[model samples]
Structures are given as structure tokens and as C-alpha cells.
Target: MNGVSEVFSTILLTSIFLALVFMLLPFSYYTIMGSVAKTEYEYVKHGFYSIATYFPMIATGGEYSIDFPSQYTSRGYIETGRIDIYLNSSSQPTLSFPCMALTQGASVGGAPRGLLYGVDTYIVNDSRMIPRIYEYRDGNGLMIMTLDTCRLLLDVNIVPTGNYSGYYYVLTYYNLTISFRGSGSLRIEPVRMYTVYSNIGGNLWNITIVVSDYILGKSFSYSVIDLVKMGFGKEYAGIPFSLTIVVEELVVEV
Candidate 1:
């Protein structure tokens, strides 16, 4: 009986020791990887032209890919080059890889993609004054199709570990993640010279690109949709709202 008891105790001790070692192995591995991640700071170089860096948000659905805009490239446009990467997961894994680009300049209209966190106001569909009726207080029936045309006020770029501030709209809209195949041609250019404002100087929001040979014979048209206004609900819906838009149309525009 004593021999039997001694054998069982030896086996229990051995099992516990092995289990401890197994649990610790993974923790040590991740620690090593985290150390390597710190190097992300070593290469950050501030400039007028920057390749887009995407700190992906956890897909929450499935594996997907998004592109970075080339407006921040050398000359406010990148024909092609390296882009910062991040997965929309706790993985926080990052990569720098080569890519093609969609037009340039600050995002104005078209399919909403990538990290669109802070955007103030944008016109939905067209700013054209169409007639759509809304029953507001019975006799007070109103037309919503025509209101102060909420133009593309602004879409602040997302940065790594940086906080950007802008008006938050709880508007109902489409937020899209798209995939395209086959070579095609698309061009995005920003026209009209203008100035806007932020929390800082009222004169701070201005488009300062110097044009060599550009012309504005007369007027322009508005086709971009306002995702923020689309997301608007009863009084901004209790603050801290997200301006996530749906892809009413699925062609990516930057």
C-alpha cells in the first residue's frame, strides 16, 4: 500500500510541473514579439508627403484588405509605394508593403472605406435641390431634399496613437470595405480654392496646394454623399457617436 501511494504522488507532481511549463511558453513567445514591435517608432519621419499607415480595426466579421490614400505621398499623390499596415484585431500586428493608389488630396466623396472616424459634414448623393416630402407635425409637413447643403466639410486623417477631433454625427449611412480586380482607370482631383476652420484658428482650414496650370471656367457640381448626415438621429444619440457610413455605392473614393 505504501508503494502504491508513493507512485501516485510522483505522477501528480510530474504532471503539474509539465503543465506549468506549457502555459509559460506562449507568454514568453509573445513577450519576445512585443519587444520587436517597439521598433515601429524608430522609423517614423514627419513630412508633407507621407505614405498611408492603416492601424486596422478588428474586422469583427472576416478577413479583409483596405488601401491607404496616396495624397500624403511626395507631391500629395503616390503613383505607388510602401504603406503602413495594421490588422483590425488585438493582434496589433503591422506591416509595411508596396501598393497602388486612388486619386489624392483629402477625401471628399464616393464609397466610404478605410478608417473614417472623424468627419464633420458631407452632401449625400447630389447637392441638387430635389423635392422629397417629410411629414413633420402633420400640417407642418416639410421638404428634406432641400436644406442647407451639407457639403464635405472635412475628413481628418487617422494617425497612429494620435487623437483627431471633429464634429461627430450619428447619421445613418453606409461604411464600406471593398475589393476590386482587373486593371482599370480612375482619376480623383480636388478643385476650387477654399478655406475652412477647426478647433484651432478659424483660418486654419485652408487648401494650400499651389497649382501650376489649372482653370475654373465657372461652376462645379456636387455628387458626393454625406455619411454623417445619413447617420444623424434624434439629437446625436447620447454623444460619443460614431460616423460609420454604409457603401450605398461600392466604388472607393479618396
Candidate 2:
């Protein structure tokens, strides 16, 4: 009888231990996977910040590539995700063409995640109206885009108008779509730039930059004064004058 009782007690303890482990298995797996996903998200965010910081150094037709993580644990498998750029105009922006960065499968707890650069309003003169980038929404997900002073000047060339006393500014807008896929190298290049100008009033001209992304089938326009406020041109003190502006286009590939 004593030997049988001892055997029964051992069996009961073993059953309880296995049951506890079975119950905790799912919780443990999720905790570890969630941690891994968060780490991957941070890594990607840092990569984007670095790119935005040095984006201006890349010249027209120049390309920059970044490697993404091999696996996104949150998605329950390894796959490539995408990074999107959006014009963030929730409020007035102080930077020249401010943008935000949004990523797919990089969120925690269903909360929105993105990066915002060049937030200092004091960096440029205040403009009457700040131009906004065309908003692009991916389902119910948020989109983000960012542009810095250097990046803004990458395609802009300012020259002295020999015929006139004022300066001539050439602003280029690249209208292209970038599709970044999983764990692969993502490449970015200023493929093409187009410029358009219209005289709004006296010295104040409505310089519109129309950018199109064919892959997304959408296009939007914003003013050029956003550049002027960044010290792109001088404010004329005398009467409002006009100059003969020429529109130009250049095409390149990734």
C-alpha cells in the first residue's frame, strides 16, 4: 500500500508540472516574439533617421540603398515590408517641405509609429501659408514623410540672373514611386525633377511643384515659397518685378 501511494503522488506532481508548462507555453512564445518585433522596429527606425540626416548629400541621379531585417516576427513569418513617405501637415510646418516616415508591420499594440525630422520652426522665416504634400493612406494605417534643408537643396540651383538684378532659382521636384520589399535592399534615387511657375500677384509668385507617383496613381502640388523662406532667394524691396521663367525636366532610373 505504501509503495502504491508513493507512485500515485509522483504521478500527480508530474501531471501538474506538465499542465503548468502547457498553460505558459503560449504566453512565453508571445512575449519573446513581441520583444523581437520591437527590436526590429527600432532598428529600422534608426536606419531611416540616418538616411534622412544624409539624404541631401545624394545628388541628382544618385542612389542610396538600405538593408531591412530578414524577419518580421510579428507577422508570424519572414517577409519583406515597405516604407512610405507622407507629407505631414497636421499643423504648420517650419521646415521646407516637411514629411513623415511610416512603415508596415512595425507597430506595437496597434499604435501608430513614425519618425518626424526638422521640426524647428525658427530655422526658416515664417511663411503666410505652408504647402502640404499630398496625403497617401494605406488602409487605416498612418503615413509619414520627412525632408531636411540639405535634401531640399539637392536639386535646387540658385544663380544670378545676369539680365536682371534679382536671382533666378531653379527648383526640381522628383515625381516617382518607390516600392521597398521584404528583407531586400531598398534603393532611392532622384530619378526626375520638373518645375512649374505661375505669377500669383506682384512679387509673390505661385510656384507649384507637381509630383506624381504612378505606382500609387496619385499626384499633388505645393508652393515654392516654402523654399524662399529657407533663404533660397532675396526679397525685393522695390516694385514687384517678373522674370521669364523656363520649365525643365530630367529623367533617370534606379
Per-residue error (Å), model 1, residue 130: 44
How do the predictions measure up, each by TM-score? 0.20, 0.55
Model 2 agreement with the true structure over 1-254: per-residue lDDT tens digits? 99999999999999999999999999999988878876776665565566555444443345666765737522111111111212223232222332222233443444433224443222223211111112222354533222222112212234445864443443332223434344344555554444433232344353443333332344544444444545444433222233223222221111
Q: What clash pairs does model 2 have? A: 80-182, 86-144, 99-145, 99-146, 100-144, 100-145, 100-146, 101-144, 101-145
Ten residues in sequence with the least summed lDDT for candidate 1: 142-151
Residue 83 miss distance in model 2 (angstroms)? 20
The Cα local distance difference test for each model comes to 0.26, 0.39
Candidate 1, 1-254: lDDT as tens digits:
99999999999999999999999999997775544332221111111012112111111121223333222221122222222222222133133222222322221222323222222222333222111111111122211010011122223232233464444322111222223342232212212222221122222212121111111112222111222223343333222222322111112222
Error of 2 at 215 (Å): 20
Candidate 2 residue-wise lDDT at 208: 41
Task: Show model 1 residue runs off by greater than 4 Å.
Answer: 40-254
How does model 1 score by TM-score?
A: 0.20
